[model samples]
Every structure is written in C-alpha cells, then in structure tokens.
Target: MSVIGKMLTLLRGSARELGESVVDANATRIYEQEIIDARNAILKAKSELTGVMAKEMQSAREIERIRAEALRLEDLALEALGKGKEALAEEVAVKIAETEQQLEEQSRVHADYALQVGKLKDLIKSAEAKVREHEREVAIARTTESVYKATRSISDNIGASGSKLLNARESLDRIKRRHEELADRMAAAESLDKETGTRALEIKLAEAGIGGDAERARRVMERIRARKTDAEGQ
Candidate 1:
C-alpha cells in the first residue's frame, strides 16, 4: 500500500469516532430533558392538590357555621312559643324550619365536597405512583445507556488500534518490496563477476589435467546457442 492510502484510512477512522461521539451526546441530552419534564409534572400535581385541600377546608368551615346558626334559631323558636305569643312564635318556627332546610342542603354540599376532596387526594396518590414509575424508567434507561457507552468505547478503541496496525503493515510491505528490488539489482550486478570466477576455476582445473578448458567452453557455448535457438523458435 502507498502512504496516501494509509493516511486516508486514518482519516476515515477519526471521522467515525467523531460521529459516534455526537450520537452519544445527543442521546444523553434527550434523557436529561425527559427527566426534567417528569419532575415538573410531579410538582404541578402536588401544587394542585394543595389548592384543592385548602378550598375543601373552607367549605367545611362554612357548613359548620350554617349548622350552628340553624340550632340557635330553633332554640329561639321554642322560647317564643313558651311565652304565649302565638303569631310571633309561629313566625320564628317558620324561620327555624327554613334555616334547618338550608343547613341540610349545606350538609349535603359539604359531604359532596369532602368526597371530591378524597378523590383529589387519590388522584395525587396516583400521580405520585406515576412519578415513581417514571423515575424507575429513567434509571433503567440510564443503565442501558451506560452499557451502550461502554461497548462503544471498547469498539472505538479497537477500531483505532486496528487502523494503526493496518497502517504499520502497509508500511512494512512497502519497505519489504523496496528491499527485494534492491536485492534483485545487486544480484544482477554480480552475475558477470560470478561467471568470470567460474571460468578462471575451470582453466586451473584443466591445466591440472582434470579436463580441457576447450572442451568445457565448447559445451557451454553449445548449451547457450541451444537456448537462443529455442527462444527464437518460440
């Protein structure tokens, strides 16, 4: 491989890492926003419950006052009847009956209000449960996110390291190719010298009666001419 190819590989790996980081940050931000929204909903539910309870208490107090006024008017009517003033006593009795009816109606309204308050309290309780559920969901999501982040970190490190190793291997291969080329050139340069040394050794051997140099040279020349003829035919 060439230097340019190795550089491009490194750049691509770095870009992948950057992309992964951006995605992780975006996910974390989204979870954070969800947590904030859940908290706000819990607070709002609590505030509304407080206001409802306050209004319920005020209604209860008004009902109690009406009940006390009804009892007082009834006592007044009895005292007037005992004094032998029939017409005035009858008027007081009528007023007492009206007050009693009003009190009864107020009592029913108060009871209804109390029931509504209880339902509101139950609603608040349900809201609290929802808040708890949201919290648990958030915790689980966070745990999953942590695992994902850890896995991604491991993958990123491995990818970076593998990229470096590939670059190194490409460098080594290029160097090895250059070394082989140099060796081939050097071998070619020594070929003539090697042939001259062999010829000299053959001449000494022939002088010592091992064989004649003329015969050896003739055989060698014949072999070379045979190879040339074969090449020309091909």
Candidate 2:
C-alpha cells in the first residue's frame, strides 16, 4: 500500500474505535439512569407503605377506643335498664353496632392498600431486571457494530489500494509502449541511414564516370545464362 493509503487505513480504524467508545459511553449512561430510576421508585413505594402502615395503626387505635367507649356506654345502659330505663339501653346497643361495622370497613381498606404496595414492589423489581437485560443487549449490539464498521473500513481501504496498484501498472505499461515506439523509430532511422549511404555511394560512382568493364559484364552475363539453362534442364 501507498503511504497515503496506510494513513487512511489507520484513520478509519481510529474512527471505528471512537464510534464504539461513544456507543459504549451512551449505553453506560442509559443503564445507570435506568438503575437509578428503578431504585428511586422502590424507595418511594417503601416510603408510601410506611405512611400507610402508620395510618392503619392509628385507625386500629381509634377502633379500639370506640370499642372501649361502647362497652362503657353498654354498662351504663344495663345499669339504667335494671332501674327500668329500657329505651336508653336500646340506643346504646345501636351505637355499638354502627361503630363495629365502621371498624371492619377500615380494616379491609388497610389490607387493600398493603396488597397494592406489594404489587408495586414486584413491578419495580421486574423493571430493574428488564433494564439490566436491555443493557446487555446494547453491549452486544455495540460490539457487533464496531466489528462490522472496522471490517468494512478495512475492506474499502484494501480495494482502494488495489485500484491504485492497477493504475500504477497501467502507467508503467504506457511508459513501456512509449519506449517501444521510440525504439522502432530509431530502427527505422538506422535503416534509412543505410539506404542513404548506399544511394550516396551509387551517385559518387556515377559522378566519377566509373562504368562496369566489358570483360567483367560479359562474365556476369555468362553466369546468368548458365543458371537459366540449369533451371530449364531441371
């Protein structure tokens, strides 16, 4: 790879790491907040339950006081009845029955409130567990995402390097072709030089008025005729 390509690869790797770090940090914050909210909800539910219990206790005390008062009134009515005050005794009996019914209703209400508080605690626990599971999922997703990003970055970098190498090869091919063309031109020039030298020698001989000798020309013609005769015989 070229220097620039190496640098790009390094930069892409760093970017992937940075992205992963950011996701991890965000996930941590989200998980922390979820935990805090769940804990707060649990604390609030407990506090409310504490207050409800205190109220229930007060109600119980009031019911006990009413029972005591009803007994005292009954005792007074019985004493009066023994003295022939039957109407006063009947009034006291009615008041005692009404107070007993009110106490029963208050007890039922207190029990219902306690049940509701228990359900709230269960819900908080479930929510906290869900938050933890979600955090784990987020961590896994971040890991996969980081791996995918890094792989993609590396693949792209490798592809770019391959393209550059191909381009370099093409450039070298062009240089080689240019060199071949120059060599061919040189060869042509050399051939032309040889041709020019031959033509110049012919002109020099003609200018010097040098013609072939009669005896030599006759000998050369005899050799040609002999060759033609041999071909005909064959």
Candidate 3:
C-alpha cells in the first residue's frame, strides 16, 4: 500500500483498539445496561401482547353473542313452523344463516389473535430468561474482577512490606554490629586499665610498705601492744 493508505489503515486500527479498550474497561456497566434494555423490550412486548389478548377476548365475546342470536333465531323458526307460518320460519332461517357466518368470521379473528398472543408470550418468556442468564454472568464477572483487584492490591502491599522489612532487618543488623563492637572496645579498655594502671598502683604501694599482708600484720601487732600498755597504767 501507499504511505497515505498505510497511514489511514494504521489510524483505523488504532481507533478500533482504543474503542475495544474503552469497551473492556466498562464491560460490566455495559453488560448491565444491555440487560436493562432487554427488560424494557420485554416489558414493551408484554404490553403489546396484552393489547392482542384483549382483542382476542373481544372477538370471542362477539362470537358468543352471534351464537346466542343464531340459537334464538332457530327457536323462533321452530315456533313459526309449529304455528304453520312457513314464510316467517324461512325469514328466521335466513337470519340464522347470516348470524352463523358472522360467528365463523369472528372465530377466525379470535383464533388469529390467540395465536399471536401465544407466540408473543413465548418470545417474551424466552427473552426474559436469556436476559436473566446474562445478568447472572455479569454479576459473576463483576465479583471476580473485584476479588482479583483486592488480591492484587494485597500482593502489592505485601511486596512493599517485604522490602521495608528487609531494610529494617539490615538496619537492626548494623545496629547490633555497632553495639557488639562498642562492647568489645569497652572490655578491651577495662582489661588494659587493670593490667597497666592497677598493677602500677599496687607496685608503688608495696614499695612504700603500705599495701601487703605483712603490713596488715605489723599494724595489728602495734595496736595489741598499745592496748597492753594502757591496761598496765590503769
């Protein structure tokens, strides 16, 4: 294809894709709206069917009236014949024939109306059932979509928390390592002080004859001697 033709084709394809995307995003809402439309259509059809049924009833009533009139005419004709009025009976017979013909026509009309009503009722019933089925499917789809979204959100939150937890663990490890290092340093400092400064002080005191078991024993002997001297003076 030429460049311009290819461009047009690409544009059309893009448009179609965009339309499909929009449709997919609003699929549940669209599905619900379609069901509503179907229900409305069924309601309208039912209304029409009601009208047809009314016509059928009217036709049936008309047929009944005609049959009643025909029966009355037959009775009148029999009475005239019993009374020897041949001409009057013949006139009544003509009317009976006309009434019967009208009854036939009205019956046909009633039959047609009845047939139409039956077919319409069946169609409406089928349509309603189909719409109901579609509605159920839409409900299922919506629930599934909601659950999927909730699950995905939970998964994302867990992923984020996992990262934060890892960071926290690393921070704790660093803090522990620092504390351990500080404790080791403190221990080393105490050991050095005991080894160097404390030993030096001990040596100094010992050279002055003031910090040993021998010095303690000498002090004790002097105190005992002083006490004995005081006792003699008393």
Question: Highest TM-score: which candidate?
Answer: 3
User: Tens digit of lDDT per residue, candidate 2, span 167-199?
Assistant: 778899999999999999999988887668776
Model 3 scores a C-alpha lDDT of 0.79
Clashes of 2: 0
Weakest ten-residue segment in model 3 by summed lDDT = 16-25
Q: Model-by-model lDDT, in order?
A: 0.69, 0.70, 0.79
* Prediction 1 TM-score vs. true: 0.50
lDDT for model 2? 0.70
Point out where model 1 deviates above 4 Å: 1-41, 162-234
**What is the C-alpha local distance difference test score of candidate 1?**
0.69
- Which residue pairs collide, candidate 1? none
> Per-residue lDDT for 1-234 in model 3, tens only?
443453345346754444323223466678788898889989999999989988998998898888889888999999999999999999999888888888888988998999999999998998898788767756655554465566667767988787533577889999999999999999999888876887777877877887686699899999999999999999
Q: Specify the highest-lDDT model's number.
A: 3
How well does candidate 2 score on lDDT at residue 136? Answer: 62
Q: Write the per-residue lDDT of candidate 1 for residues 1-234, one digit (tens) a residue.
A: 443453345346754454333233454466567657756766776787687677778877877887788788777777887888788878977887887788788778777767777876676677666556545544554554465578788778988787533577889999999999999999976886656777767767777757786678878999999999999999
